[model samples]
Target: MLFSGGKLDNQALLTNQAQKMADVPLMITFDGEWGLSMRLRGTPVFPKTWY
Candidate 1:
């Protein structure tokens, strides 16, 4: 599970590292809430509360 500012960006980094170590399968998973943003890119804020 990787929760960071950049999801796909982070995945690329991890993939590179994994390739260096050895060829292996890497599964990246994220919470559904990842698509929601309260004030992303300076837009109107819609506060979200998880759980």
Candidate 2:
């Protein structure tokens, strides 16, 4: 599982390398059910609305 407190640039660099080695295109997606800040540090928190 991915965690917080990591540089996004580093992650992108790694993803790029993996994509090149991959035979098929990889679709990267993020699930921030809570907020971006929950997974990625230093980002603005987009809180979810609860009813």
Candidate 3:
């Protein structure tokens, strides 16, 4: 699933929902150009060292 937002609360709910239905691999991708520090709450933030 894909989502774009800076709201922590909304992201939390989405993450919880994804966890409950853990049958599929949830690839949560986000763009941080505008500052991703806020949208990445309660979730693992990948390092940009590779790409």
Candidate 4:
């Protein structure tokens, strides 16, 4: 599973790596509280937390 590490943010790099591991399914895990844009750019961001 992909986590909060800044390594996987590169789409081109991820795509290349994923192609190499075609046998395995890739899963991206994001913290719902922060939203997917927490690390990467050009994504939706929630203003506040539910809790």
Clashes of each: 0, 0, 0, 0
Candidate 4 off by > 4 Å: 1-9, 12-20
Q: Which predicted model would earn the best TM-score? A: 2
- Cα RMSD for candidate 4? 3.4
C-alpha root-mean-square deviation, candidate 2: 2.9
lDDT order of candidates, best first?
2, 3, 4, 1
TM-score of each: 0.33, 0.59, 0.49, 0.45
Poorest lDDT segment (10 consecutive residues) of candidate 1? 36-45
* lDDT (C-alpha) at residue 43 in model 2: 74
Query: What is each predicted model's overall lDDT from 0 to 1?
Result: 0.50, 0.69, 0.68, 0.61
Report the C-alpha lDDT of model 1 over 1-40, residue by residue, as the tens digit: 3433444555567767876776566564544363524212
Model 2 earns a TM-score of 0.59
For model 4, how does the per-residue alpha-carbon lDDT over 1-51 read when each residue is reduced to its tens digit?
455535334754776687688887666555544766676565666686766
Instruction: Check candidate 1 and list the clashing pairs.
Output: none
Instruction: Report lDDT (Cα) of residue 33, candidate 3.
Output: 54
Among residues 3 or more apart in sequence or in different chains, the pairs in candidate 3 whose N, CA or C atoms overlap within 3 Å are none
Candidate 3 scores a C-alpha RMSD against the true structure in Å of 5.8
Off by over 4 Å in 3: 37-51
What residue pairs clash in candidate 4, if any at all? none
Per-residue CA lDDT of candidate 2, range 1-51, in tens?
243446567667777887899899887766667876667766787758898
